[model samples]
Target chain A: MSNALSVKNLNVSYLGNVALTNVSFQVDEGALVGIIGPNGAGKSTLIKAMMGLIPSETGKVEILGKPIRKTRKEIAYVPQRNDIDWDFPIHVIDAVMIGTYPHLGLFKRPKKQEREWAYQCLERVGMQDYGKRQIGELSGGQQQRVFLARALAQNADIFFLDEPFVGVDVSSENTIMQILKELQKEGKTTLVVHHDLSKANVYFDELILLNKELIAKGEVTDVLEVNTIQKAYGNPLAFMKNEIGVKQA
Target chain B: MNFIEAIIHYEFLQKALITSVMVGIICGVIGCFIILRGMALMGDAISHAVLPGVAISYMLGINFFFGAVITGVLTAIGIGFVSQNSRLKNDTAIGILFTFAFAAGIILITFMKSSTDLYHILFGNVLAVRPSDMWVTLVIGILVIAGVYFFYKELLVTSFDPTMASAYGLSTKLVHYLLMTMLTMVTVASLQTVGIVLVVAMLITPAATAYLLTDRLWVMIYLASGFGVVASVIGLYFSFMYNLSSGATIVLVSTLLFITVFLFSPRHGFIRKVIKSRKRASLAN
Candidate 1:
């Protein structure tokens, strides 16, 4: 089977300070991979670099054996919830409908069917009733659900979510994970930049452990060992271990 | 006769009225985007920065629009470059670049000793507008409004969430520059009616009023355009009857409209919120 995403020698920097260095990773089809690391360890930066949201100094990114740009319509990215100005004057439905905009060329508006499809995506995320509400009025979890609805509306082959679970309520978390699993079943590849190390083990199929460099990339069961977690986190895994132990219990 | 008869009788009055309405509509439409994007200061900066372009065009005996547009775009790029490349914020970049351009304009006007009246450019004389100026404004107004209509969705996404715009393969940079260019055009086009001193008001007040009244972008645009035209017409009428300054009167009218909306708009106005809170307090008692 062809690889869903392939990254080679990816390097990124900000103001002469290196963020990611010589990072290489690849994901096979229909895999749910989590990229986890310590704070400021370039987990977000790696997602941005792979999505071409930021310019990489030296790297190559290919999606399903083709350049990423040619398949833009086949990819969806949901940035962190805080990345948006929620108070912007947009209705929730209008925000979700923007997902369909990439498939349109200049001068083409979203048709009625596309609008209905956006409503359906919102339904999938249980946000159909709040479609008329302003984005600012929604809670953090609802805001996140709206973002997921937007990504779903894109109908993409590959999905990238950066810190999707941060600040989300428990029910919203379950809703998102359920939708992501459904996407995987549909043969879509999902890469998530996760922050919670405890949930990382249980949530992802594969893992890319990093601390400004790729430490391990394999099945979660193999990569979640104490030694590997210590290498990525730069400390003993006492906090993570306690949380994981509680979760397992 | 009455005001209606005077408008029908005087060709100059008709021209002034037509020019005011067109300028009002264009500025109001474009202003919605400017204020929504929090680029109100950028609007003020670009409007003032076009002074040097006008001065240079007068000295070169060329159409002022060409010089004004070029200078406006350069000012935008300069502000963008300074903000992006340095640690300075956007406000600092706008202040530095606009003042530099404005100073250059004042110096050029003094040095060249051009015959064009600087006072009229600084504080516009809508009554003195020539037919050619009216035509130029019309063409620019149509082009800009059409551009906004055609690229509405692209502009919406890019302005609301640029990161998503990029992830979905829209070039955020190109959209930004395109908006800057349109802003430059609208600034230049409105110069003849509102002048640089109050162009920012013409661009912001009516839109701000509409913003208070509506939750939808299209409705905001529609309401703002209507408010703009009404303000301009009323202002022109008052200027005609009272022998006052047209630009200043138009700005004053729009400001008055905004104040009304601020106090009384049903959705987001201060008075409405206050009233609702008072009712809730009484009900609790």
Candidate 2:
């Protein structure tokens, strides 16, 4: 089977500061991979580099075994909510409909069927009532739901999401995970830049731990051992040896 | 004279009415993008900046539309350049360019000292609407509306969520350039009716008023165009009655409309709140 996404020697820079160095990873079809690291660990940069959202200095990224330049429409991207301006005049439904632009082709407005599809995507993420609400009116968690709805509306085979669960409520977080599980069941590949180590283990089928580089990759249980977790996160059982371990997350 | 006989008596008034209405339609349609992109003041800046371009074009005996379009595009490109190349903020660059261009226009107007219809340059000559000016605006207006419709979604998406648009393979840079080009055309086209000083009022006030009345972008566009037309007609009437500059009168009407909307909008206005409170008190009693 072809890889859903492949990255090699992916390094990125920002203002003369090295953000990511010598990173390599690949996602198999139907995989839910979580990339976790501390602040400034370039987890977001890896996603940006892979999605071609930010130009990479040196690296190669392929989507569905084809270069990003050629296969740009085959992938979907969900940036962190804060990455976009909430005060923009667009309503939630319109924002979700934009996900179809890549497939809609230039100068082609979304037809009635496409709009209904957007409505269904909103219903999928519990944003049905918010179809006409301006994005500025949504809460952080609700905005994340809108972003997820947008990605779902894309109907792409591979999805790249940067920090989808950040600042989300427990209920919203679980809903997002359930959505991701459904995507995996549908044979879609999802690469998420996750932060909370607690849910990272339970949520992701495969975990790619990183600290500005590819530190470890494999099954979450195998690669998330205390020592490796410490190496990747600068912590070993730091939240362990307690009854509520990973519970306060 | 009977009422119908009085209606078609004045040819200049009829010409003013026609010229100002066309200018209103073009500005209202194209100004929607300017308002959405928060580049409302850009129209004022470039309108004034075209002064030197116009004078030079006149010296060479070329079409002033060519000069206005060239200068307007150049000014917009300069702002685009600064926004991309430097850390300087967009409004700061706007302020810088706004001053330099307006000053250049003022200096040029003083130096030209030509009797070739200075009223048309400074305060707009709606009554002096020539056939060539009408033809230029009609062609350009059609082109602008068509361009906007072609990229309607792309421009809307980019204006609303630039990052999401770009991520989805839509080039926000290209959209930005297209918007700037449209604005340049709109400003140059409106020069004959609104003049440079009042162009911002024409470009921003209608949209802002319509923005207060509706949350739907499409509806806002429609309402704004209507408001612009109404304001122009009212202004033309006043200009004919009181011997005032039609452009200034139109801007004043637009300002009054803004005040009305700002003070009485149902959602956020104080008067609306007061009325709602009174009604609620009566219901409780």
In candidate 1, stretches whose alpha carbon ends up further than 4 angstroms from where it belongs are: A245-249, B111-116, B275-285
Clashes of each: 0, 0
> Per-residue lDDT for B1-42 in model 1, tens only?
677899999998899989999988988898988888899999
Mark the regions of model 2 whose C-alpha exceeds 4 Å error after superposition. Answer: A137-139, A232-237, A240-249, B1-7, B115-119, B268-285
Give the DockQ (2 decimals) of all models.
Answer: 0.75, 0.49
lDDT of 2: 0.79
lDDT of each: 0.88, 0.79
Model 1: DockQ against the native? 0.75
Q: Chain B, model 1, TM-score against the native?
A: 0.96
Candidate 2: residue A160 lDDT (0-100): 83
